[model samples]
Target: MPKESYNVIGVMSGTSLDGIDLAHVVFEVSDGNWTFDIEESQTISYSDAWLQKLKIAVNFHKDELEKLNSDYTILLGETIRGFIEKHGIGNLDAVCSHGHTILHQPHNGFTLQIGNLPKIAKIAGQKVICDFRVEDVALGGQGAPLVPIGDRILFSDYDYCLNLGGFSNVSFENHGLRLAFDISPVNTVLNFYANRLGFEYDDKGKLAESGKIDHELLSSLNNLAYYRQSFPKSLGFEFVKNTVLPLIESFDVSDIDKLRTFTEHIAVQIASALPKKSGKLLATGGGAYNRFLISRMQEQLPQIKIEIPEKKILEFKEALIFALLGVLKMRNETNVLASVTGAKRDHSSGKSYEN
Candidate 1:
């Protein structure tokens, strides 16, 4: 008989450089329905050196990145081992991880997420499931917004599931098809300007609240071609570095003003992407905590009720969903949706390393 329960740790590292998120979850299936309990969760912040390394890794050459990938895998393994020891966790099925994304240009026929080496199983002394995106890309998909599958199964009550992380992506059912795509750059750009002012991020967007929005800058940002693109598309740190930051730097405005304008830009882009019809929108991720940004979205989406879930779901939804992806992979079930990613077909996507 197929297993109906899984005890697993879902690990995630976002492009925002926020930190590594670890969630110890128990998922149970009954009568074809699934439910989950997040027993323990934590976010391990990266050191300054590591943060700087990841920020510039996108520009590293092949050989240099190869070494970085190996090193990152070791670090990732150690982190998982420590979490297990600290919590006295046992009887785990596997460690499911979305290794930090270094380069995600699927249009170029490739994507790179470091730290999925098979050695991770040896280091963590447990089975591991990871490197989930490469197969989707190989199958001619955007290899992104993989969380939508989890949404369709776990949080289907919401008409729309919007995750505001490094980038904002929304998943929803359209004509019985699951559709999702990256909406716009979120903390990836916001944190850039915030870091310029010696802060990790704009607290509640207060700094931006104090400044005036530069309409010209806002207009230029909204006009970004990526926003005009259709579903099955995604954004990465590369887009922010090569296109977004340079454009923002071209304007002669106060950093605070830039923050304000960009915040508005995010709101506008997200609002535009959502449907005008009335429905519930579940907003999660670090960006969901930004009260000001959420308010702006509420203003533009009056008909669409935006709901920020509980603390655990708000901060660790991706980790929890990634855990679901891992479970599906173990069952040899279809986890990547062709409708959402524009893949050639629906299939089970992940690498399994049994120790």
Candidate 2:
């Protein structure tokens, strides 16, 4: 008989460079339905040195990138080990990790996530399931927004699941098919501007709320070509570094105004991407805390009701989903949705190493 439950640790690092999130979770199945309990969770802030290295890793040469990948694997292993020790956690089925993304160009048929080497299982002293996106890319998919499957299974109460993470992405059902795509850049761009102002992030979007909106800059941002593209699409730091940053930097506005304008852009993009009918929209990820941004979004889509979950889900939802992804892989069940990622077919993804 198959196991009815799994205890796992999920690890993730987003493009925003906010930090690495670790969640200890237990998933159980009953009557073909799934539920989870978040046992423990923490976010370990990255050091200045590591933040710089990861930020520039996309520009690294092949050799340098290989070394960086190896070092990152070690760092991730040590981090997971520490979390386990701190919680005195034992009997984990696996440690599921979405390593930091260095390069994500699914259109070019490649996406690289560091810290997924097989040795991580040995270092962390547990079985591991990771490198979840590579296979989907190999099958001609965007290799992103992998959380929708979890949304479908564990959070079906809502009509939409909007994740305001490093990048904003949404998942929902349309005509019996699960559809999802990246809405726009969220914290990935907001945090960059905030860092320039000597703050890690715009607390409650207070700085943005105080600044004036640059309508011209906002218009240009709204007209970007990516917004017009259809579903099964995604964005990465490359798009932000090459396209978004350059466009935003070309303006002479103050950083505060830039923040204000960009926050409006995010709100507009999110509203435009969502269906305009009355429904429940479950918003999660770090951006949910941005009161100003949420207010703008709510104003734009008056019919949609946005629900902010508890602190654990708001912060560690991605990590929690990755834990579920690991459990599915252990059971050889479909974890990545072909409809969401535009893959060749629905399939079980990720590489598993039993230590």
Candidate 3:
């Protein structure tokens, strides 16, 4: 029989480069239903040196990337150790990590997430389950927006699960299948412009609120080919660098104007992706805190009720879900959904390493 309960640490580093999110989670299975509690959670900000390296890592050569991968694994191990010791965590069954993504081009049949090396298990002194995306992509899937499984199992009360992380993505059941796709860029683009103005983020979009929308830029963004694509699609740093940034840079607008225009674009795209029917939308991730953005989305999606959960769920939902993925992997159960990712079939995905 499968174990009834598990305690694990879920570590996540998003494209927004906000920091490393560590969540100590307890998952219990009762009568085939799953429940989770995030006992402790924290975000550890990255240093300037690490931040600079990671931002340019996608352009690194194969050997360089391998070295960085090893270094990052060590860094992740050390960080997880600190988190465990600081919280006095004990009896950990495993550490489930969504190692920081560097290159996510599923079209090319590969995606790379650093810090999943075997050395991590040794350094952290615990069993580790990670690299969850590669297998899904190997089976011909987008290999992203992996949190929908958690949404389906843990938070099934809502009709839609929308996450505004580095990128914006949404998942919901339709026609007896879970459908999901990336809607638009979020902090990945906004924070880039915000950094130019000497701020980490827009602080509830106050900067964007003060700025005017550039209609021309907005139209260009909306017309991008990615928007017209079907579901099971995703966005990555390459998309931002090659497609999004160039389009925005073509307009000689103020930084605040760019932020405002992009924020509006994000809201419109997200609203457009939803079904016309009225239902509850559960919003989470860092972007959920951007009050102005959420208000704009509310305006566009008036019929759909947008609900934001408590602070813990808002910030650490992805990490918590990654923990669930690890648990599913340990049980040899399906964690990656074929319908959501467009994989060949649903399967348990992740490599496990014992310390």
Q: What is the lDDT of residue 5 in candidate 3?
A: 97
Q: Encode model 2's per-residue lDDT on 209-305: one tens digit a residue.
A: 9999999999999999999998889998999999999999999999999999999999999989987557999999999999999999999989999
lDDT of 3 at 292: 99
* Error of model 2, residue 300, in angstroms: 0.5
Model 1 lDDT on a 0 to 1 scale:
0.92
Clashing pairs in 2: none
The model with the greater lDDT, 1 or 2, is 2
Judge candidate 3 at residue 95 and give its lDDT: 98
lDDT of 1 by residue, 102-150 (tens): 9998999899999999999999898999999999999999999899999
Candidate 3 residue-wise lDDT, 273-298, digit = tens: 98754799999999999999999999
> Relative to the true structure, how large is the alpha-carbon lDDT of every model?
0.92, 0.94, 0.94
What would you estimate as the lDDT of candidate 2? 0.94
Where does model 2 exceed 4 Å of error?
A: none
Q: What TM-score, to 2 decimals, does candidate 2 have?
A: 0.99
Model 2: lDDT of residue 63: 100
